[model samples]
Target: MQIRPCADAFYASELEPWSEYISGQQGKDPGYDVLGWMIEETHKRGMEFHAWMNPYRISNSATAFATSGAANHPAKLHPEWTMKYDNLLIYRPALPEVKQHLLNVVDDLISKYDVDGIHFDDYFYPYPKGGVEIDDAADYAKYGAGYSNVGDFRRAQVDEVIEKIHNLLVAKKPGIVFSISPYGVWRNKASDPVAGSDSNSLQNYDDLYADVRKWCQNGWIDLVVPQLYASTSNVNMNFTKMCTWWNANSFEAKLAIGHALYRFGVPAEGAPYQTLDQLSDQFRISRSNKNTCGSFLFNATCFNENKINILSRLAQVYADKALIPVIGKESEAAPAKAGDIAVEGRTIAWKEQPGMRYAVYTVKPSSVEGKWDAKLTAVLAEPSWLAPGAGNYAVSVLNRDNAESELSQPVKVD
Candidate 1:
């Protein structure tokens, strides 16, 4: 599960430190941190927590929000660093201050929370509106060093941000994955010599100024989840065709398909997410490819609402709980073997290994040795794990990259 901590002004958040710019000062805090609660809850369910954001966007509409202190907002403080386009206030990527502010927000997240990954979707430059000009002439003139054209310069700014963030993640926390889910089509075949996809729609490079292909080629991110929100049958943005393209192109990052679960049973002009089966088919198609790591649903609320029986269809696909796919540099290390396993009452403990996490598994006492259908009880940072019940328990060492070592001998407890 992922929480949009630093989203547009609509969400009342405590994701960032509560000073003057957060919801806390405005009396919007619900007596708890939303991101903290989400992280704990998601971990309890044995799922990874990804902190997500739509960078550059401060607001989605024209209505001026009443912040606790408008002067405290970076948008208000540095008005020149932002642009008003499509009725939204967006931070200009070219500005050094704007890029630094975003980097600081990410730094705050990593320092404060224990998120498995950081996510950014395609919200770089606003979806274009005809005749709506973004006046970044001063920024372009000052900062456009290597690029001749403004378009290329804008793309470079976004690229720099991605590279900087990747560097920060590697330096501060190497295990934490950095991912971007850019718009599905990176570039059409007509646009670039290396572009392979045939879909002729809003390209990430041309329209949004997001050079996704460059990021992948340069190893700037750990995962690239292209928002393949189209139906497999849609001619413009075919899901199957795009998945094939992404898998072939994923250089250093793992490819995870972002399925548009929210669109299930929704109407459209030429293509509709007609049924739950459409999403199921997308899942199956993603799994069929060797490069495909996993998929992420658009929003978690859909499962809660059980929109158009999607939860049930998902249940069929996810019959068993699975570990998050290890990626990036972390996946290369195999953790050392677990040692000195012991159990007393309802507690299980093992000798600690350097830079390793412990995965505790439990099976029935009477279960056959070879037929040991062990279920993962807990993955703890510490060597000790609380025994779930009266079952035989085994422990293994999981390394920084999530690689698990061979299981130690099982200890039976009454």
Candidate 2:
């Protein structure tokens, strides 16, 4: 259940707000603060917690109506604000009330969770359906006052919501990253001669009504990860070529690739994906593109099925640790370097610097005597750490924006 009901309540009961005070009262209720505990557990394990949301999706299937949860769902309550495009139920994007409702939802989300980032994938206007013309002409006539065409008006509606959301993120959590992974192709050359991708494919612009390229150019989002779910040799939509294309267009935002890991070993996915090297090749392409900071694997659960030996290739590629690429306001002030560092056995402690995360590096022969390689060992939210094994350790400070300080004096361990 959500803490606060948004526009339509989305069929949720009002729960307690997430806060340190609520979290500190853990023993009172058995189900108290699950979200808070998840954040704590994730941070404790040196991983970032990002909240992913499909902003407009209400119901996945028509059968969802069978459940009592469906009865109170906003889509059911305010059916006027919804569209049944195929069996999928979605909020009408052109409505002002829907935009305000979505803003309220996002406001409630960021206000409650201790998430490191907010992630949204290509879920704007539903991918255009065949023979199904969007019947939003009346909505457009009402709300599309300044725009010329319905397409342009549709895109503008999406743009306004995104701009408002970006402003909200900036105001509420300046350091929090807001990212969108839209369809890989903004437009095919056939669609937009000059700015379109060379490949022929469905676009985020004309079809989906999501001007993802415009978002990147406008710098409204922090990161623009295109779902480049293709192989290196895929001539139509080559992975390498797409990476380069996105980099050139990403303006001030960082770029990342969205890999289709679910198709890696699937036979029906075609020749390119049949070869296990597909993912490795994609990573190689992403790394070669200097603007790419990281990547996201689709259906994140795909990695768990290692019977296909998915980890081996990536293990070699990711043998060393790297600090998170700096994001958020690039001009924010950096935190003070961790000083008065001490080592007791394999357990190291440093000066407590509140509101900052600590990065601990394992010192090898190359990193000793202050010539550090910065091979990150672990990032800790707490001031102390119990090293995995005996070795030299050094610590650094990281601001909310992930700005890192110089490594502290290395302490030796047997």
Candidate 3:
């Protein structure tokens, strides 16, 4: 696995990325398993864990390189696989070795952990630097023999990596989701004319060489989250227009809106972010599209601060905890329902098949007689649950795709 080892167990192992991290404050804890611990904890709360990775980015800045990179680091071990731009290090995508290394990293992650998905962000090729160009002409000459333009050749290289990784995931762990969050605009009408967003913005296709649309078209990914960060009023890239464009372009993969929560209460972001109902407004539009599954916030910490009460508003919008949407034809079949539901002493337990999550619900009084109002309490990975207080409860088996089965026989506490 290309993931940096932080556990104390790796201190004596050959795979330790560097001795510095293991020896420093953040790393080399007595017996801390950072990544594994995170996955375990997340699943315990009935949440799916997706390991987010940036494929090409090696270093954020010169300071990051010096502090993080060691003699054992890939940048130091294989300098030929790296490109330095703006005091940053990026892996060369054209190299076959580089692609294999990325695949190896993914294989290592999914094999060793119970992660639900593998996630890739917008970065493919490095973002363009003004008046500066990526110097891959020589490699293009060797690899792009038949192609006239280097840009087309560069895109083809990226596409091949994405497809290969998708294939690997399907072969190794078919249950694991493959997801990508790319820049909102794929291309502008001015650029493509036939099939493109109406907004004028930096495009993933023309700029970053990330063809997220094609990935969805080919069913190469399970989910597509477009970072529609601009305000609704902005003429350059209106939020609604960008969102609609993405929903329209949504092919086989599920669509999700990426709201810029980080901009909330920031004066420079203009009035939209400052407005209290901005996020809800965007979410309303998201629900308008049947293909839109849900929405993601830019910075999760934004909810912690509750700046402008965005978190409180979200609590209202998402009153009930909903299961993640199931996608693809294969995911359509629902698993067998949970059975033998019982509340023994303090625990509520059930019997279900393997690789299933429990959707625990609280049964409340209904307006009509002989009926009950059930609210989803939590999606639990474990077979048993402990309720907050004595109450009526029900459990349902949620398959990996969250294709929920029929409710188990309801149980009431005395």
lDDT of 3 by residue, 99-167 (tens): 888777777767777778878878888888887778677678778887789888888889999999889
Worst 10 residues of 3 by lDDT: 1-10
lDDT of each: 0.77, 0.75, 0.77
Q: For each candidate, what TM-score against the reference?
A: 0.83, 0.89, 0.89
Candidate 2 residue runs with Cα over 4 Å from true position: 1-32, 66-69, 330-333, 364-370, 388-390
Candidate 1: Cα lDDT at 340: 85
Which residue pairs overlap in candidate 1's backbone?
330-401
- What is the Cα-based TM-score of model 2? 0.89
Model 2 clash pairs? none
Q: Global lDDT for candidate 1? A: 0.77
Q: Model 2, residue 402: what's the lDDT?
A: 83
